[model samples]
Target: MKFNYLVFFALCGFLNLSAQEYYFPKANADWEQKSPKTFKIKDAPLQEAVAFAEANEYSGSRDLRIAIVKGFEREPFHQILGRTKKRGGPAGMIIKNGYIVAQWGDTKRVDMTFSVTKSFLSTMAGLAEDEGKIADTKDLVIDYIWDGTFDGAHNSKITWEHLLQQNSAWSGELWGGKDWADRPPSDGDIDDWKLAQPKEPGTVMEYNDVRVNVLAYSLTHVWRKPMPLVLKEKVMDKIGASTTWRWFGYDNAWTEIDGLQMKSVTGGGHSGAGMFISAEDMARFGLLFLNNGKWKNEQLISEKWIKKATTPSTPNANYGYMWWLNQKGDRHWEGLSENIYYAAGFGGNFIVIDKEHDLVVVTRWLEPSKVGEFMTKVNAAF
Candidate 1:
């Protein structure tokens, strides 16, 4: 029995080693064949980077510290151990001047991007406009979604811009309580629910999932196809996203947003969590935007569209078309005249694009934390 137990442990160890050996073959291949190897900061500069990061108020920096302290409890090692405890676990990447500068964590592991997907969806909507698929942002959402449920006076006046800015004025707790992660509206009583419009569009900034859902529904109506299919064909395939990664709608169907039951036009569907991709793939997306929608001379998204999406157009002055505008200032309020914009997810996931610095930083984590301090530190370094 003792001998058998020893043999079993040895086999398990061997299997784990084998899995680790091939953990990032794709990343290795990309390094060797697809692109140049990622640049690494030297030890002296790295120490300064660590110190700067540690002193920041950013949750990502703290999380990185915690991750190190906890010994990385996850998989895909890439950094150093002991001083940080774990090497690489779940990955993140930074791009500057069209080259990958730093990468940490599992470079190949893909995970849910949550609301950062909104930024991409907004980009698609911009494309839809450029292609003449959708007329303009001011177009009435109800014109596209003529479903009987939207007949209420409030719902009739809602526009695509309103949905994009979360100013649709619809009220209901979509992100709280039992329905926190995956709760859909009642289908049987769908028509019975009434949506209230805000006193005026662009006056208020309310972060609601239902508004995004309405955007999804409206886009589907205009495109005459499912959101995921549109995204896959229009964006993902063009970008050459890895086959191991998949973007899901609400549900499982390729055509369905959240499963086949719900449509993308449902309120808050566009803003809340619905899309999934790998960290590296997300970095590619950030790079695309950093390059003004150009990828190696191929314009996947129009430069005009990119500018409008990132530029602020609402009263809040901190939001653009489904993206967050980062201004210069302290923790109290966003200061004036800053050129940074980012797509922020619920937790600590961020794809920050700094036009002034010509840099893009992408990060992902399981915990819900802010990266402001970390951003400040990184920006200061630059």
Candidate 2:
């Protein structure tokens, strides 16, 4: 039995070594090496903020203090990549009282934000509504999109609200097929890829990427500009996101779709996928939403729009207009709350805002381990 135990321990050590060697990059990449000009928190008293973050118990080894301290000197993106690659854990950021208080891992590194881009798209939809470019969420997509090619019996019933809520009933397979990647669609061929719609819209909460693509298409049809440009001129510019950040789309005009270059997409835009930005800038976005779309005294996104975007319009928990709602309940289950909304991407990219506590947390990483525990610690600190 003792020999068996020894063998087991040896195997475990080997596995750990392999994991470390496999995941971590040998030489630090650009994201892993960039640092923020200012890493200090300006909202609450600094000592108190530090104490609060220190009080929380993260699930990792307590010996992590040395690494955490080393992170202070490292670039935010590198720190996050290091932790994610080494520990296979989530990165974190915390904003309290309108100032960034604490962060862990590669807090500033930008990665694919996955569905979180949906929330941004939803905000744009609201802007369109406010501009009278779109009448309302209930407006049929055909109203905005030209060609009316998608005006089938099933698709005809799809509305802006249906798409926003991820209930457009479109098959995800159409966009996600392996073959589809090889034969990329032409600039104008996006409409030809539309698939058969489901039986009903809004009856089920199906997370469909194609619906988001259609939303982008609809936006382009109305604004006569690419989705990214609209987002840049309206959202990113208004919020003062750093020039370092890039939102991907087709053509430099924002209509081109190179899968690798464009991270944020309409469904999950290219920019959002690998949207690169400093963690501080991501915190700025959180603060902008926390203040109900006001940044530096500028009314960027309207309060009404913010509220509507974060509020869950479907039965799905933690699902708002493309944002994830984080409520206080079972950690495994969904449904955060109206007070806390987040822009979450896959592999654990997050921009979390706690309105009641005046807190925002942003994290970017390559994996999803320990995210729950990290979030728990952050919540406790609040």
Which candidate achieves the best lDDT against the true structure? Answer: 1
Q: Candidate 2: minimum summed lDDT over ten consecutive residues — where? A: 18-27
| Candidate 2: clashing residue pairs, number | 27
lDDT of 1: 0.56
lDDT of 1 by residue, 255-287 (tens): 233334444422211322265567777777776
Q: Give lDDT: candidate 2, residue 155.
A: 72
Report the lDDT of model 2 for residue 343.
77
**Runs in model 1 lying further than 4 Å from the true structure:** 1-90, 171-199, 251-273, 328-337, 366-370
lDDT of 2 by residue, 1-382 (tens): 2368656876777443322221111112321221221333233443333344334423432233343334233211212111111222344566555543565655545444445566667777877877888877788886666465356676777888777877776433222321122223345453344432344787766554545666766666666665667777887766656566544432222232333223224445321222444565667667767776766546777787777776766556557677766644322323233467777654456677776556676665523444555555445443
Q: Which ten residues in a row have the lowest lDDT in candidate 1?
A: 78-87
Candidate 2 achieves a global lDDT of 0.54
TM-scores of all models?
0.68, 0.64
Superposition error at 129 for model 2 (Å): 1.5
